[model samples]
Target: MTSVPTVPFHDGQSIPQLGYGVWRVEDDVAADVVAQAIRAGYHHIDTAAIYGNEEGVGRAVAAAGVPREELFITTKVWNSAHGYDEALAALEESLGKLGTDYVDLWLIHWAKPTQGRYVDTWKALIEAQRQGKVRSIGVSNFPAEQLEEIIEATGVVPVIHQVETHPYWQQRELREVEERHGILHESWSPLGQGGELLEDPEITAIAEAHGATPAQVVIAWHLAKGFVVIPKSVTSERIVSNLAAADVELTEDEVARIDALDREDGRIGPDPATIEF
Candidate 1:
């Protein structure tokens, strides 16, 4: 099995750089699929309340044969749960469903700037951490300003920021902001969510050169750029192959070639700045 590298968090903990994400996976099959991922050498699993698969993920974890301490589990509070109390309650509910006493990491699914309560939610996460219910806490889909707001309000920087990132939407500016604050950048759509990214001429050419699949090349690109990436798949072969991306080595120039694929209109997800939900 290929060894996945770990990224250090500002909180003194570390996370596997590569993880298995359950985004659109239905609850019915998530357990089996996640089990396959674990059997293929994935130590980190990312789930969220809105994904409706935490229970299945929990079941898989219980049956994985891998000890709880060896696997890194992450879940998030949804947008509906935006206030301080609601966020804490949300974490507790997630814990109950995950069948774990504490999650390795918990996050606010979105800033939901319209509600204007992420700061309070961040405080709630701080309280949860202090209570020993969570080992690390962070946010997803947060912009530079909101990241600053939460940190300013609580004096605790997020250890990681999960967002939509790929070769096309590289998030250069926001990544710079996160880098300045010692926050790790995590890519939610590292393979572009099964879109044209895998079919791009540049990606295919690079994949051929490395004798790898397009998805592997893309995952390798994310790893080379130092962004924590979670690529989701229900197929067992793809799950194993994606993890094999750890073996695909890319030169600095190749990484730059992928970087040049970034464009002004490359964003496929909602803009975090104006997203209400």
Candidate 2:
């Protein structure tokens, strides 16, 4: 089995630096694909209530033959459940679907600033942690200001902040803010959705030099930058290969070359600041 490094959280817990993300994975096939990922040596599994596959992920966890304590499971509360009571109910529902009494990490899926309820939802996550229903609490797609707002409101900083990040969109400024608060930056679309990013000449050259695939090179870059990354793929071979990225090493220059690929308009996902949902 490959040894994956872990990033420590401010709350004394830790998360695997690399994880399996089941975002677009269908519920029916989630169990099979997640099981394959587990067999490929992935101990971190990222899912969300919006993904609608927590049941399948739970099914795989129950049968993986690996003890539950050894796996890092994460789930998020969706935009619809944005109030304190609603978020609490959402966690209960997710816990039921995941078939676990406590989730390793729970997140508010989006800030939905327009709705003006994320602060209340964040309170719910804080409560969940206090109740021992969640080990760590965090947010996804939350901008730096909102991050500060939540902390000021509750005086509890999120242990992790997940966002769309890749070589094309390095998120340097946001990462700086997170770093100041001791929050880990986790990448969602770490491969830039796997098309243009994997075929970029710079990444391809790095891969060729290392005798690795473009995806591995990119994953290696994420690791080298100390960002927790989750690259999703349903293919069994790709799942295993992605995990092998843990072994791909990159030099400082190569990592800098990839870092220089960041663009002012490289964002491919919804901008959290303006997103309605």
RMSD to native for every prediction? 0.8, 0.7
lDDT of each: 0.94, 0.95
**Per-residue lDDT over 60-120 for candidate 1, one digit per residue giving the tens place of the 0 to 100 score:** 9999999999999999999898898999899989999999999999999888888898899
Please list all clashing residue pairs in model 2, or write none if there are none.
none
| Candidate 1 clashes between residue pairs 3 or more apart in a chain or in different chains | none
TM-score on alpha carbons, each prediction: 0.99, 0.99
List residue ranges in candidate 1 displaced over 4 A.
none
